[model samples]
Target: MAAPALSPLARIAREQDPDRFLCALFAPAERREALFALIAYNAELARARAMASRPMAALIRLQWWRDTVAEAAARPPPRHEVAGPLAMAIRAGALDPADLAAMADAREAETEELPFPTREGFHAYLRGTAGRFAIAAGRLLGAPAEALPGLEARGVAYGAAGVLRAAPALARQGRCLLPADLLAAHGLSAEAAARDPGAPAWRALARDLLDGGGLAAPPAGRLPAAWIAAALPAVLARRDARRLRRSGLAAPPRPGRPLADRLAVTWAALRRRA
Candidate 1:
């Protein structure tokens, strides 16, 4: 007999974020759908900002997801494909609505023209959204409470790297993610960075951001099997951060061949590395 088809949420996850989806494969089968659902929902939230043509459009779409989360809180078995599975994960993982809601709230920053006013502000934004997602993912993966700080750091690294990778695209949209103080310190304006991504000042700022992005050094020894799987994105993020610094925004890192990425994750899981 043939294998069953993936649900809508699973396909969203597998198609939109193959790296994290590949890592989730290490999770037990019965729990995999919940993981996919959580990731897919996050992708949806992210896409709201990525796909919107205007800030108002992004706000409208984000509001929709926020409302969906509210409705899901009031009632189980949400109506949409992504929401339904997300609701299940919420219940199964005992996730807090406030945390999920905060993720949506933080995404509002993405729609703004000048989002990160300061370095500390940028870090706080990342912690609220990406760091929060890591905590939620760890909970679903059955991570111990003691492991959360590590997971949160890993998430911050991935989130910062992801944002830095999107710098070119964001620049084209006439928006910048770099902190205002960093841009000022380098004597580079957002317009200048957007217009000439290859400029020396812009490259210097990118290198600085990548260096301070909170990408923790890999653990010296093996981690637990579950954590190793859950932290795979951080591994990929570190590679991306390095590439972003070396290559600049014009040549951000690619996801690489899917097979290679999956193999690397599998090796990491087997060896219990991040």
Candidate 2:
């Protein structure tokens, strides 16, 4: 059953994700196409199961995504699907197959309760899970592979910061992404956060995360120096917006960032890679 779910991996491989494909287009056309499929498959996996239900079920489902990656590769990467893009990325850059698999692991962490002993622990998770992903993107854009470790540090910080900023809204899914200890330190319970919209600790946490992320610099590198730069500011702005919402005690919008504006921004950024 799991092996077959991989079919979407193939289908998604062929179909283009506007943001990723467009970003890739900014680089060498030969280079961009290779990574688009890899990114698309990961996106598909996230879409396949939007939120958590049971940890056991979520873990099993995550395994399926991992298997899908394997199954897709069992045969030659499809003509235009994720496999081919990944194949190209591997040839042109320093991406590791297992690094992509790490994303699935990160998703699994969300399935169960997230408990970071300290903020540092949370940062570590962000780097391994999200930082590496940014590095993979950077690699496709012609950044040096050796630079990934430091760059990963910065990318993960941004990711953790984003998640922290969004903590209030994300709790709606009945899971908390921030460290439970941090919330407890502020005298809030995860249960209270999910149920109590007025929780001060939630806002405080969001403020800290946004400030932390906003003050942090994007790593000095060829990747963000090029196309990733276009994307980074927007990511920061989003973190800022979420921080504002949390601080203002405003509820998350029933509908998020308007699509038209988003499309415009995404397209414009991709076109301006430098």
Q: CA shift at 269, candidate 1, in angstroms?
A: 1.5
Candidate 1 lDDT, tens digit per residue, 1-274? 9988977777889998776788787776776887787788778888887798888999999898887777664676667778777776666555556768888998888888785889898988888877888877787777899987888888888888777667766777787877888778888766675567666666577778767544443453467776555677777776666656766665534544445556766777777788
Candidate 2 lDDT tens digits, 123-198: 6667656576667666656666565555565556556655654555666765566766667767775556556655
- Backbone clash pairs in model 1 (N, Cα, C under 3 Å; residues 3+ apart or in different chains), count: 0
Candidate 2, pairs of clashing residues: 13-81, 13-82, 34-85
Point out where model 1 deviates above 4 Å.
Answer: 1-4, 192-199, 213-221, 252-262
With a 3 Å backbone cut-off (N, CA, C), the pairs that clash in candidate 1 are none
lDDT per model vs. reference: 0.75, 0.55
Distance from true position, residue 117, model 2, in Å?
4.3
Best candidate according to TM-score: 1
lDDT of residue 185 for candidate 2: 69
Q: What root-mean-square deviation over C-alphas does model 2 reach?
A: 6.9
